[model samples]
Target: MAKLKEKKALMIIAERNFRDEELLEPKKILEDREIKVTIASTSLQNSRGMLGATVKPDLLLSSVKVQDYDVIIFVGGGGASQYWNDPLAHSIAQKAVQKDKILGAICIAPVTLANAGVLSGKKATVFSSEISKLEAKGAIYTGKPVQVEGKIITGEGPQSAEQFGEAIVKVLENLPE
Candidate 1:
């Protein structure tokens, strides 16, 4: 297979309690495709995963700009729920969408997308536990593993992380640089 022409930057944005599987699985998939994956967070010291694992970030949200990437992904977990309304998280989601970059949110991270005004009137799928929250924010909820509507893509939960990663890869392959 010819190498994909498009280059994607997988942005894994997590909080202190992000799920390990949700972030790692997708990241591994993207990197296997030779796409650059950057792990960014609210802070840079270290963030704890949902299962009590520790993860380091490649960049800090305060330091990184969104336009440098072709794709921006939000990793979801219990920690994301607490920080979904964060101004910095919201800012990244909003700016990525505004720039027409491929935006993704898995599990509870979709709440951040809703908070960023990216899901309004768009068909999306997120972890079912928060479907009502997304709907309340004007999202058209789809109860599925992965849903890609335009430049935005969302996955249901950790169980669907692999599919979500593949979906993102497919989208990246199709989009021109």
Candidate 2:
């Protein structure tokens, strides 16, 4: 708890149509716990959510340095699919794992982690529609609202955002320094 006050988290969102709750809920919970949050996107311009929320990203996704943050999260929506095959996004996910940072994805965004090859053999959950794709990537789909495997967390959808946030917080609280 003492060290969590200085924890930092990087949240990646689609430049358009990121799920509102998926991004907002977890962010609020993390902030409430004193975790610093930074927003990144493919485009730095204001990004809009599917439900009409908007965010001005603090940095370009391409400009991100994985080592700067203790946690990395991918917010999901129809637009999150844009990252599913993106090489940079995949590299970020891989680096997060290699660096021992907490990593997360909500809704369809978990597909990006799956595609990045980090989700293989990990227990995860994602938006219902992408179940087969996640399974194809060698992930064990738990069908839970939120699944936490080691330092990786996956949320089923918008409804699971709070649980997803709490899961990350719980892990951070228990993380070995």
Candidate 3:
């Protein structure tokens, strides 16, 4: 038997509105395994979810250092579009890819990654409304509830949040220890 290496995950949510389940479901899955989860957002104030789950961000997105975590996830909602073309979000996504850290997004947040140029040639999925944006970025849209391609993971929407979290944990657990 061997002790597992500690893992840390950074979850980015929208300042005003994020999908509650998308953030909570995944955060629970990761924390159950004793993995540390940090919440980040565009602002340092409390973030309100679409479903009314208010969360205080631990840090601002502009201050994130990709090297500090094993995974980086963007929680999606109607407001997730705020990061669709955001340079800071795109830069973070690119750095995560460049560093080979597990990258994940649920619902519409995948659009942020697609726009970041890291989804090119990767298999991914997103909320139906965002399919074209992913396809336009050269990502093969699989339309699955949850899709895991290499170290990148994407979920169709809130209903897929749990499976998305499971997929991320699977990837993290299987990484060379």
Candidate 4:
């Protein structure tokens, strides 16, 4: 077997409130494999999760340069809507795709990618409430527990958090060194 290259992932969470499991589960999976994970948000302060998990961001989103990581994941919650039309979030998503980096989004977080124009013609899944929004952005809605199209992965909601993380790890593991 070939040795896997060291991998790093950037996880973006809403500054105020994000879904706890959606961020934690995937982060744990990546770390378990020795993949470095950096938590980032709009601010450097502690961001609170819906279920009370407080995470201090390692970096501000504005400081992120797409070339620094192999994967970029956007964690979702009601607060994730804050990035739906955010230009910085959109720019980051666009740059991730341009760099062929793995992109992951769960729940409504996919909306941010959609608005970034990266989801067009890609098969994706999102929380039910944002299905039409995703479709409107030209994404083919799969409605699956987890959807992986190319390097982009999307999950429906909190219930699929574990599966979502596993999917990301699987994709990362398969990448060429």
Candidate number with greatest lDDT: 2
Question: Which of the two, 2 or 4, has more TM-score?
Answer: 2
Clashes of 2: 0
Cα lDDT of model 1 by residue, 1-177, tens digit: 324434657566565888888888988898888887888886787899888778889888787688888889989888887557788778888899889988999998898899788899999998878998899999999898999998899999999999999998888777754
Could you estimate the TM-score for every candidate? 0.92, 0.98, 0.97, 0.97
Q: lDDT tens string, model 3, 1-177? A: 212248889999999879999999999999998889999998999999999999999999989999999999999998899999999999999999999999999999999999999999999999998899999999999999999999999999999999999999998888876
Judge candidate 2 at residue 48 and give its lDDT.
Answer: 97
| Backbone clash pairs in model 1 (N, Cα, C under 3 Å; residues 3+ apart or in different chains), count | 0
Model 1 poorest ten-residue lDDT run: 1-10
Residues 1-177 of candidate 2: C-alpha lDDT, one tens digit per residue: 438889999999999999999999999999999899999999989999999998999999999999999999999998999999999999999999999999999999999999999999999999999999999999999999999999999999998999999999999999876
Candidate RMSDs in Å, in order, are: 1.9, 0.8, 1.4, 1.2
How well does candidate 1 score on lDDT at residue 139? 97
The ten-residue window of minimal lDDT in model 3 covers 1-10
What TM-score does candidate 1 get on C-alpha atoms? 0.92
RMSD of 3: 1.4
Candidate rank order under lDDT: 2, 3, 4, 1
- Assess each prediction's global lDDT (C-alpha) against the native: 0.84, 0.96, 0.93, 0.93
The TM-score measured for candidate 2 stands at 0.98
How far residue 109's Cα lies from its native spot in candidate 4, in Å, is: 0.2
Candidate 4's residue-wise lDDT over 1-177, tens digit each?
A: 213247889999999779999999999888888888999998898899999999999999999999999899999998999999999999999999999999999999999999999999999999999999999999999999999999999999999999999999888878776
